[model samples]
Target chain A: MAVPRELRQISDAVWELPVSWKPGMRVPARLYGTRDLVEHFDDGVFEQAANVATLPGIQKYSFCMPDGHWGYGFPIGGVAAFDPDEGVISPGGIGFDINCGMRLVATNLTCGEVEPHLHRLVDRLFERIPSGVGSTGFVKLDEDEFLDVVEQGSRWCLRNGYALPEDLELTEEQGCMEGADAAKVSHKAVQRGHNQIGTLGSGNHYLEVQVARKENIFNPGLARAFGITMPDQVVVMYHCGSRGFGHQVATDYLHVLLDVMERVYGIRIIDKELACAPFRSPQGQDYFSAMKCAVNMSFANRQVILHRVREVFSDVFGKSPDDLGIRQVYDVTHNTAKLEEHVIDGRRRRVLIHRKGSTRAFGPGMEGIPERYKPFGQPVIIGGSMETGSYLLAGVESGDQTFYSTAHGSGRVMSRHSARKKYQGKKLVREMQFRGIYVRTASLRGLAEEAGGAYKDIDAVARASELAGISTPVAKLTPIGNIKG
Target chain B: MPYTYLEEIAIADVAFEARADTREALFVEAGDALMNVMVEDLKSVRPLVRRSFHAQAEDLERLLFEYLQQFIFFKDAEQLLLRVSKVAITQETGVLGLTAEAAGEKIDPSRHDLNADVKAVTLHRFRVRNEPAGLIATVVLDI
Candidate 1:
């Protein structure tokens, strides 16, 4: 797709489409990426950005990060903020996988100490952690019990002896975001979530065991703050979301918003996928409250998965997780609509910040971050492809220019069908095994679709993120073993 | 083939266009297309469960949207793999009515080869059009 002629280059890594470029735009649309990255973006990014700019009470500009790509309503890696009182809340901006996020756990065991037992460890982890389509976890809750999990978030994990107290502090929003209304969630959604609490669902969701060496640390101080003290440290990462619970919530609300936007509110939507309601409206508040429940459910889900990971490690190494120093570094979400206070035009105003396929990168001294991480800033975990490496970045103080958001992953550049034509799952599995990265998946066709050739280069994305001033590099970790769902 | 797989618009997303002489056949074929994404064989499982669904919308677009969503809801809630056996569509003025009956059995991994889970039917590029041969419906599934 051709880049829109109206887009003007603001800097080597930034482009802008002025409000005049489109008829209904209330503000300009800004895109941040290296020149190469910008050229790789689909034209859908600009179209969605322009459409988002036309929404009511959008502050600053509609923004897209370096990894931005075509998505249903908002382009992946899109960011937009709207005033709580005057603006609207759109689930399309939040994505279907509500609160879809990443969590990093650091262990005292080094690569050298665990290498001889690597195969066994991977096998054990795969066995202990339920994954793949139609897979269920150990947590089977009734309607009342499921609602409790929704309301308590990770606190439910702590009470059920699945997590530690420190785990909550390192998690975003203390792992218990406020405003959850379980009653607002549907009975069908609850039933869908009843048995999926700790399972990793299929499609782009997985658990990877990586090794980070001290030599890879970009900022030694920040790395130490994140508990990366030694070279060749073994760390485990989980990338998942609220599962079917969140999907049903978004699906149900989209129907309501589509009807109310036209019949009751009389608001015109540029795209049916962008269905929404005014933030303060009864319909909007109800969706927000229900979305909070999905968010907490996801938090509790990951917390329980962490407990399972600890058990696998203990079983393999013959020691307790506490003695193994297996502690959570941080857990942050990418897909959400959060009500936060940010200084715009030198005044603190409450706004709903919607980040779709983008990570929240809060700079140092931001409220809600852990006290120990206050000076170092929040940890931003970017999961690269199965073959490429991942990175650990911190939010910069100057990140406020784009509402303090950054890219979530090395975004896909090729279509899945194109990828399947180029790579074979069996051959790719052999290649990964030769590269010392053990690969396990339930479906080979699904594996072929996720070939590393389908996505952009991680190093380039990390560099563009730093150059754009949204996040700063702290450490780089390479994968030793990966489990794909 | 009852349905033809459509070209993907974005990486990892799945879509299909179902066609039949009648609206009922189109709905049944659409269900088969959705279930095939999760399992390799459609005829391997027995009919252990039978379910019925009814939905109404102001237009055909919204009605098809609700119809596809019902299959996903059942898959997640009951662990059932369903194929729509019968469907009926009616219209009076602007209101559209849809009734569907589907039959399937539990998902047993040993017997059925499970594939990617179809999360939900997305609104992007979803449509129902009348072609020269028959009624054709297009759907994009969020996998």
Candidate 2:
């Protein structure tokens, strides 16, 4: 669809829709993208952004990043912060895959060293890490122990010998978020999560081995600080979430909010997908608490997988994990609502920031970041499609305008069915192999659905993010191997 | 058509319309449509494993929601990739209840050509309505 008629061009990379553009909008809607990207955006992006502006007690503006696309209620790259007292908590704002984020591990091994074993490494990694639909992980928790898994997050992983303590420190919220009450999560959700702790769920989820290219390093010093120092440095990136646990939590809460939204709060929503409850209401607090459990579960999930990744590298390279120096660079969640303090209108106030398919890009000196990362800012891991390659970026000062949030991935441009119709997964696999990227996948059809042509250009999306000044590129990593779930 | 996949929704998601002469048939067809999105062929699924599911909701629409969610729950929890074999719906005093039977086997990558692992059935444009022919259900799935 064409750009909204009333959208005002704020800059080359920013556009705004005045509150008057919609009847009940409490704030304006701001979207970040270059002209070409915005022009290619799905129609739902504008509709969802406009609907977000009308939510209760929205602060500043409803924002969409460069890779914005049509999601259920919010645009995929949508970011909106709400006042604690007057605003509402939306399940749609966080998405079904709660804490669906990226974890980057920097290894001392280089492409030159891994090239001979790239195929074997991919095979071993795929075999070691459970993935795809209905895949089960090594961790199985009973009722009581499951609570610890959700409540402790990566801390549980550390205690269970699944992660190093430093892994948690490099993770957002230190890998464990507060306010999680296992009792708040449904028994069904627990059942779904129990056997799936470390399994990577299907659909756009993957584990990729990549090589950092020196020419792509925009900020060499920053890259070095984040653990990348030389060209061809090998890194592993995993993209996943709380498995079925998070999906169930969102499903359960959406029903609750739908039942109470209009009657209890007298709130009107344009779409049922945007269902929510007042932040302080029992229903809202319960959902929030349950959501935190999913958030922590995801952290623990990735932490366990990180350990498995380390094991595979050690086994393949014949070096101890410690000797390999396969340290976690960072882990950042893109789909979540965190209670944070951001300065708005010259006032520092606590707000619930909802980042649906948007990564947290807190700039240097942000209060919540770790002491070591304070100087270089938080590392934002943006995973592109298998073909386009990914990037390691750092939050920049200007990002405060978007509440320190940025694009999460190269958003899809074609439907799965369309991609399947146009491309063959086996052929694509061969193509990737010919290009020197080994691939292991569960389903050929599923693989075809993620054809590179189906997504926006990762380079262009990253450029728009930098031009918009929300985040600055640090280093680019090209994939050497990939495993798809 | 009992059901036809719709193409207007976002590229990352799957949307489809299910229709039948009765709500029960519509519900059955809807479940089948959901399963078809994941597997290349529904007939390939054997009835070696069977499950019984019961759901109740304030209305028919919500009942459909609960039914579809059960399919996803089973897929994740039991590793059962099922097809709705039978569906019976009862409506009384504005409440709708459903009893359904699903039959299939575990998802085997070697045996089954999987397309997508549907995360959940979303409420985005989700609805059931009566039409000239009978009833129609429209659903957008998060895959």
Clashing pairs in 2: A415-B11
What interface RMSD does each of the candidate structures achieve?
Answer: 1.4, 1.1
- Local distance difference test, candidate 1: 0.88
Please, what are the lDDT tens digits per residue for candidate 1 over residues A341-421? 899999988889999999999999999789999999899999888888789999989899888899999888877667767
Ten-residue stretch with the least lDDT total in model 2 chain A: A135-144
- Number of clashes recorded per candidate: 0, 1
How high is the lDDT of residue A273 in model 2?
Answer: 88
Query: In model 1, what lDDT does residue A205 have?
Result: 85
lDDT on C-alpha atoms for all candidate structures = 0.88, 0.91
Across B1-143, the per-residue lDDT of candidate 1 in tens digits comes to: 86887765655588888898887788888888888888878997678889998999887777888888887888878888888888988888879898898889888877887778888889988988998989899888888
**TM accuracy, model 2:** 0.99
Question: Stretches of candidate 2 above 4 Å error?
Answer: none
TM-score for chain B of each model, two decimals: 0.93, 0.96
Instruction: Supply the DockQ value of model 1.
Output: 0.69
- lDDT (Cα, tens digit) per residue for candidate 2, span B4-86: 99886766989999999988788899999998888878888889999998999988888998999988898888888998878
DockQ of each: 0.69, 0.76
Question: Which candidate number maximizes lDDT?
Answer: 2
